[model samples]
Target: MHAIKIRLSQEELEQLENLAGAGYSLEQIAMYLDVPKNDFIAEFYDLDSFVNYHYKRGLLMVDAAAGLALAANAAGGNITAHQQLEKIRMAQFVEREKKRIIYGQETP
Candidate 1:
């Protein structure tokens, strides 16, 4: 089945990214866009789709912001932030190790 493509203006695309970065769900985003939820879901059925790509990019923006905040706080000697940063580092290490084990040393 062919997927329906929605043409979005640059402004709309930025709006989508901002909304996604603010942690809006797909259904909520659809409402904000004035599109039916099912249509939005159908258009963004896969990771490769532009909508989903923007969504994930938005999430990455949030991750980057949070990481920066955590690092800044840790640098300022906030004990709780330091512990949180360490936990994040450990989780990232564990994820990399799991990928290495599953995909061998060839894993990036």
Candidate 2:
């Protein structure tokens, strides 16, 4: 995959850490990154790719959390209602993001 350079500051780094520590999924982080949801979905088809991509950028915590979320979404065991709920919420978030892009609310 071709990578475009995106910049982040110290404040964003701290925020990402907090979110990852709280078990936020890749989709959630992607949303926080403010890339249009549709673009994030197309580039990252699943959480695994997201983890690997982010890990290469030094997001250790987020990568590990993405791994857990991907695993839970893959296997049908040991998943709590909260994770399931977050998954659903992220799905809806992606859909809404698509809508925003379609409506031209998303900046390139």
lDDT of 2: 0.58
Q: Which lDDT values do the candidates have, in the order given? A: 0.83, 0.58
Candidate 1, pairs of clashing residues? none
Question: Per-residue alpha-carbon lDDT of model 2 for 49-72, expressed as tens digits?
Answer: 443344345455655576667666
Best by TM-score: 1
Error of 1 at 87 (Å): 1.4
Q: On a 0 to 100 scale, what is the lDDT of residue 57 in model 1?
A: 83
Error of 1 at 35 (Å): 2.0
Cα lDDT of model 1 by residue, 10-40, tens digit: 7777788899999899999989988778878
Q: For model 2, how many clashes?
A: 0
